[model samples]
Target: MTDQLDDLIATVQEQERRLVLTRFTHDDAWALGSLVVGLARERGLPVTVDVTRGAQQLFHAALEGTAAHNDVWIARKVATVRELGTSSFLAGLQARARGEVFEDAPWIDATRMAGHGGAFPITVEGAGVVGTLTVSGLPQADDHALAVEALELFRAG
Candidate 1:
């Protein structure tokens, strides 16, 4: 699966380079959330999207078919990004590939840290990662792909 991971890492790095924001203000967050939600609707995806910076939740939405637990999963995925500086899916895969369980990671609390998928770091070109944009409710791979796709679409415009 490292081969697949290698590709995902490259895609993520490309996004980091392509999606830099000079400043992610409240308006930007709202626009981003709306855009992501629009995309989800178009694809008939039942998921939750969240964008947060530090302690501030900039944007949040739960699509039609999502349950409240999707929000819980998003929180866990966000925690994974906070601790690893990488997408949660990649972090989880790397941990398992190493014969380690993410729950046992020294720096994470299993109850709060979920190294699944659907969280991507929001990067500011000169400032580094400032926040995360996340989606949850699909299969882990699909969740990650959807987040990446959203970022790509946002970047293209």
Candidate 2:
């Protein structure tokens, strides 16, 4: 990995570590989901962010739409907690580099797939992928933009 990738990963990992130790709620699913969806739309991407755990609560409805409510379907396991060192995340980076969208592409095996609606693992050098950053319910270019924007924010902070 390049020096810049290393540095960016380090910074993002530090932030994730802080959030974990502090039990921060700001980075929770609802909050992060809103940010991802809003940013994607701001970038002119059609977006729908499903919490994948939320029931059809009023709050859930207000957050995005009925799809945001996690109760309607067999909720995929929530993976909000940061996981920078996992093989799952590592594969995501490699897949992205190959010009393939792993999560949304159904051709990949179930075990190898990213479970979230469409998450792009944010990866950096030594730190690896810090978390699942996603932007979907849109065109490929728009989806990529959402992840890119999230990575930019991660790097900035």
Candidate 3:
């Protein structure tokens, strides 16, 4: 389990290093959000997608079968990304690798932050992580994958 966790951490770190945006704007957020929404629709996924730049929420959508609680999850996951400057998934994996629970960390407030997968940093080339892209309502890994897939597609286009 430790080795697997370490491998996963490496993969997530590589993803964070590779999936960077040149710049993030309100229009870019809409485009990225639309891509995520379309991907979810194609897969018949019930999820909520959110994009934020710093403290500003640029785009948000709740798909079919998703509940309001998904937004709460989004908030917590986004907080994780904001605090860690990495994918929320990576934060969880790092904690596991250290034999610690993420929420048990002294600096984390469980109510406002979560290390669950789903939130990814929206990193710009020069500005570092300017925002976050998040999804919720599926299993943590799946939610993280969905966000990563959308980002890959958006980056490719």
Candidate 4:
């Protein structure tokens, strides 16, 4: 997995022509969040992404809207916290990969729609967390897949 991660990082750096292949950071999280959200929208998922504050703060407003299933949302957390919340959500999903579970800690209605999402921690070899890549607006499975795709792109650069 670490090798795969390294490959991913290299890919992203090569393609983006940037030097973020270090540890993932808040800035990366913001970029990842924004990119995935925009991609989702382009894919007709009707989503939004903002890595300004914590993930909760970023999506708090959008969740209030009247979007139906396939509606996407994203947010970047503080520098230290970064995408911690979103990462936890992704870990939980990975833990329960076999089935779907309804989670209420953040007070989200998981079953209302496909109700699933994921956040990836982008980090450089020694730079620490550069950012996060998160995606929502599709079934949990699809969301995870999309997130991976985005990460792959980021690394392929």
- Specify the highest-TM-score model's number: 3
Candidate 4, residues 1-157, lDDT tens digits: the string is 6565455444533423332364345555556566666566576664333343223333311222226332333332122125232342443443344343434434433332122444444555655554444454455446556666666665665
Q: Which of the two, 1 or 3, has more lDDT?
A: 3
Ranking by TM-score: 3, 1, 4, 2
What TM-score do all the candidates reach, one by one?
Answer: 0.88, 0.39, 0.97, 0.46
Clashes of 1: 0
Tell me the TM-score of model 3.
Answer: 0.97
How does residue 106 of candidate 3 score in lDDT?
93
Against the reference, the lDDT scores of all candidates come to: 0.82, 0.40, 0.93, 0.44
Candidate 4: misplaced stretches above 4 Å?
1-20, 23-34, 52-90, 94-116
Pairs clashing within candidate 3: none
Q: Each candidate's root-mean-square deviation in Å? A: 1.9, 8.3, 0.8, 8.6
Best by lDDT: 3
* lDDT of each residue in 1-157, candidate 1, tens digit only: 7777667656655655676777767777787778889988998999899998865889999999999999999999998888777888878777776778877888778889897888988777777778888999899878888877877777666
Candidate 4 CA-lDDT value: 0.44
Mark the regions of model 3 whose C-alpha exceeds 4 Å error after superposition: none
Residue runs of model 1 more than 4 Å from their true location after superposition: 5-14
Score candidate 1 by lDDT.
0.82
Error of 3 at 69 (Å): 1.1
